[model samples]
Target: MKPLIVKLGGSVITNKRRRFTVKRATLTRLARELSVAKGPLVIVHGGGSFGHPVASKYGIAEGYKSKDQLMGLSLTHRAMERLNSYVIEALQKASLPAIAVQPSACAVVSGGRIQSMELTPIQKMLALGLIPVLYGDAVPDLSKGMSILSGDQLVVQLARELGGKRVILGVDVDGVYTVNPKTNKNAELIQEISLSNWPSVEKRLTGVVEGRDVTGGIANKMRELLALAERGVEAEIVNAAKPNILKRAILGEVGLGTRVVAR
Candidate 1:
């Protein structure tokens, strides 16, 4: 079996309502869930409160335009690193050997996107029975001078370059819903999404999400994740906060969450 590319959604792991807070109990639960994955697991976590707020304040996602963005770059990277440290520590406490792979150090960015990645460090980390924990980060961009690469986008890049057939996103919500579940009591969960229903699904997926998310939320993720499926990588969006949803998804258990079809 290929390595499972698992993304721990920021909202699920971080207490975004507060500044720089990590839900330790939530992460501990997640670590337990991820422990059951049958194949080698590559863990990528969102920056959560640690990343989004600073990036938003600095406009890091807008691509570099001024020297002033440099301070923001350092601040944003440091914030993300702080979050990564918490995640790694929690996983380690769960007896999962994990090491942090700082994205900015190893990934080459251009035009505010990952232009190239040096995979030897990551490949070697997995080979050593240590799971490499990566997160959304700021990196040098040729076109913009600097850009914030989101965990969502990093999932695709890692899966593509590192050889993963299954991509999983563990979010706070059960799965994709017709409306933002937080705001609408009448929101409906859609079980399976493919090209067949995406046109209609896309229309119903609109709503403003509350958070400091620099990377676009679920709606934006759907498109990139679907494109990943089109390349023969099957993806799932599950409620990672719920017990065993992540484990079940990794184990290929159906009826748990929304599955992005592999076409």
Candidate 2:
């Protein structure tokens, strides 16, 4: 049984461009499916349409301003918590034992590195057969004051630390593509990527999307997360919009997605 770390993309949950509202049916289905999974599980989700656009609207994206940053941070944190509660409750209703642990509360990042990850509690819960859920939000940083930690980045770090044999990142697209599939119909899904070939992938990503889009985006995410694969931690990017893919990935069954592994 591999230690599974599944990242729930914000876009899949909420339409951030509009306003933050719970995608009730999707979350309900996800919770139902995850409840019966047979393995140690850790879940992370993005802020989606709820917190991010608000932060961007108030200029919170450019690192937090002391005053507005705090306000923005408060808003962002609350929004994530709201989503977290909804997920947790749904999981509970589905008979899945789960707990929500806010990374900002116990995680400490110094000099842009995860200096420490206090995982004893999470480990304890997982050992007791409870799923631990984390999300992307504002976390404290010694140098930058407060920083936004994407759920994607958090999963990469957690997968490395937990030594998961594989990490499956469910995203909005088919998989890592040569171009944003939305804009470029010609974009082809690349089956595999390595750290060495990432430069070429990054170069080809011009204007199809923003860096942050690529932050959680498959190509760039696979690049940053390649270190885990180097250590023999397999990873993949799949479309989260699909209803049943998560269950397939959890079962170690082949499903739609680009698999990223060590070359």
Candidate 3:
């Protein structure tokens, strides 16, 4: 089996509005689920409410040049670090032998896109059977100077580099749906999505699906993931709160989630 890249959403880990109050019990369950997984696994998480608000306050939404923006960016990164530490601690408690490998410390950016990802240390960790946990962070960029790289984006890079055969995003929602399940009782979970139909599916999605999704919400994530699918990587979006979903996917069992695939 190829490597599995798991992206845990901050929203699923904490209250959507508060990132510091780590949901210990939920993550404790998640860590336990991942601990028993087989072969190499790479875990990545979002900043949730922790980094976004602070980064917005500093006006670092895109790029930062001003001192105020820089200050805010610093706080934003610290917030990510805070959340990262909590996740790392949880994994350790579960005896997963996880390591916090900060993306900013190694990645160099050009323009607004990722120019390259070193991933050497992560590769070494996987080789040693150690899980590498990465988080969304503010990183250096040549075009805009420093920019925030969402964990979702990092998952794409890592998947490509590691030749990840499976990519699972654990989000608040049960799966991608035709309508906001919170409001529409008739809303149905989309079982499979192709690259050709992603845009239309994305446009129809609403509620809780917004810019804040570190995994880029339904649309952007589908776009990014479909591209990866074309390269032979399989990706899915499922409810992270349900620990069984992760295990089922790893076990190659038919699951209740959205599978993004090539056209």
Candidate 4:
């Protein structure tokens, strides 16, 4: 069976408002939920408080411009690694054979877009019944010295390359909203997003929420997932902050979140 690509959004896994804070209880619970999965899985995670701040401070996403940014690149990659370690620990505590796959060491990008990535290790890990955990990290860019690779973009790449049939995005919200639900009382949940209605939905999405996300936030996520949808890989954005939702979403339960489809 093709592996399912699961993304643990930075906002859901960590306290994005605070720097470097991991929601331990939430992480542990989610790990336990993931342990119930019975098929091949590739887990990708966002940087949240861990990586975004450091990268933003150095303008790392704008690409390499000076020697001054060298430290930021190192620091950004280190921050992501630190976060990845926490995820690895949680997965292992749940008795899942999870291994960290450093995207910085394996991926190369051009203009902040993935040009190529080493996938053999991930492929082998699945064959061995192991889950490969990847995260957003600083990577070498052909045009710029380096750039930030978002987990959203990584999900699309992995799903396309690995022949994944489904992608589950675990975010803090219930799903895509007509507006930023956190700040708007009138915002309604969008149950489904398709190519035909995407143009209209795109207009309703607000800019990045009050956070240091350099990955273009929800707007970027929608764009990337839409591209994947065009390729026939269905994706769902669900509220992972709530208990059991992520587990059900991963288990193929529908209607709990906004479904993004080609049609």
Candidate 5:
């Protein structure tokens, strides 16, 4: 079987309004749930409170400003480290042999995009029955010196390289909707989306509710998944803000979330 790509969104893992805070109980529960998966899992996570705040302030995503931006980049990396450490510890406590890998160390970025990703470490980790956890981070950019790469972009790269047929995103919302549910009361939950209706669906999406994200947020996520769908890979979005939904999605359950089908 091909490896599964799962993304733990920042909204699901942390309080976006709170600075540098993680939802430990939710993460631990998710780890325990993921511990039972029988297939190889490549987990990619968003920056959430840890990365987005600092990077947004420094315009890191804008890419290669001055040496002054280096301070913001350094601070972003440190925050990612701290957040990843907590996640790794939680996964380990759940008996999942999860290892942390930095995207900047292996992936080459240029023009705010990943030009190349070194997948050797991820392959080896999966072969050894371990989970490889990747988080959004600032990476060297040939065009600008460095750029903030989003986890959504990493999911597409992982799925393409690892022979993944599906990419799952656990977010705060139950699934993709016709409008921003957080604000619009008439927003309808879109149970399924595919190439045929993607253009319209893309029109309905609302960007981030809170938090400073240099990455394009949900808009970026939709475009990335749409690209994957065009390649015959499907992406699922489930509600991770609550509980148990993420575990269920990881277990390959369907009908509980929105499914992005190939056109």
Candidate 6:
């Protein structure tokens, strides 16, 4: 069976308003929910408060320009690892065989896009019934010295390369909305988005989002997921902050969140 790819959005897993603060209770609950999955799984997570704040502080996303940025790159990678540790610990406590796969260690990019990655380990791990966890990180780039690899982009690459069945993005919002849902009470939820109607939907999407997300935020996520849709892979953006929602979404329940389709 193909593995299901689940991305734990930064805002859902961490307190984006605070630095290095992991929402332990929420993460544990989500991990427990993930433990119910009966098949292979791959978890990709966002940087949120941990990595995003630090990355933005030193302009890590713009790539290496000065010798000072080398330290920024190092700090950024360390922060992501720290966040990944929390995720790995939570999944382990929930009895899910999860292992952290550092993107920086195995991936090289050019212009903030994946160029090559060592996937044999992840493939073998999946074959052994272990869930491989990955996240957005700063990685070496051919065009630039280093770049930020967003979890959204990683989901697209992994699903396509590993032939994932479906991708579920566990986000703070209930689903995609006409505007920034957090700030706009009038924003309407967009339950279904497809390639044909995406242009229209795109016009209504506001880039205004919470946190210091250096990785292009929700708009970039939509673009990335749409690319996956173009290849016939479907994805969902669900309110992972809600109880049982992530579990249900992983179990194939529909109508709980926004669904992005190829058509």
Q: TM-scores, in order shown?
A: 0.94, 0.90, 0.91, 0.96, 0.95, 0.97
Q: For candidate 5, list the clashing residue pairs, or say none.
A: none
Pairs in clash, predicted candidate 2:
16-49
Instruction: List, residue by residue over 145-261, the lDDT tens digit for candidate 2.
Output: 767777877888788777766777777677777777877788877766677777786676542222243134545566667878888887777776788887777777653687776
Residue-level lDDT tens digits of model 6 in 1-263: 88899999998899988889999999999999998787889999999899998888888889888898889989999999999999999999998889999999998899999988999999999999999999999888899888899998999999999999999989888888887777778989988988899999888887343344788766777877888888878998899999999999999997788999978
- RMSD to truth, every model: 1.7, 2.4, 2.1, 1.4, 1.6, 1.3
Candidate achieving the largest lDDT: 6
Which stretches of model 3 miss by more than 4 angstroms?
183-186, 199-203, 206-217
**Tens digits of lDDT, candidate 5, 135-177:** 9998779998878888888999989888886788887888877
TM-score of 6: 0.97
Off by over 4 Å in 2: 196-199, 207-220
Against the reference, the lDDT scores of all candidates come to 0.84, 0.74, 0.79, 0.88, 0.83, 0.89
Best by TM-score: 6
Better of 5 and 6 by lDDT: 6
Error of 5 at 146 (Å): 1.6
Which TM-score value belongs to model 4? 0.96
Give me the overall lDDT of model 6: 0.89
Model 5, which residues run further than 4 Å from truth? 206-212
* Per-residue lDDT of candidate 3, residues 1-263 (tens digit): 46889988877787766546778898888888777678888999987778777766675656766877777777888999998888999999988888998888888876546788887788888999888999988877778877878888889998998899789888877877887776788887888888778767777767443235422456666778899999998888888777677667666654568888886
Error of 2 at 149 (Å): 1.2
Model 5 quality (TM-score) = 0.95
Clashes of 2: 1
lDDT of residue 33 for candidate 4: 90
Span of 10 residues, lowest total lDDT, candidate 5: 205-214
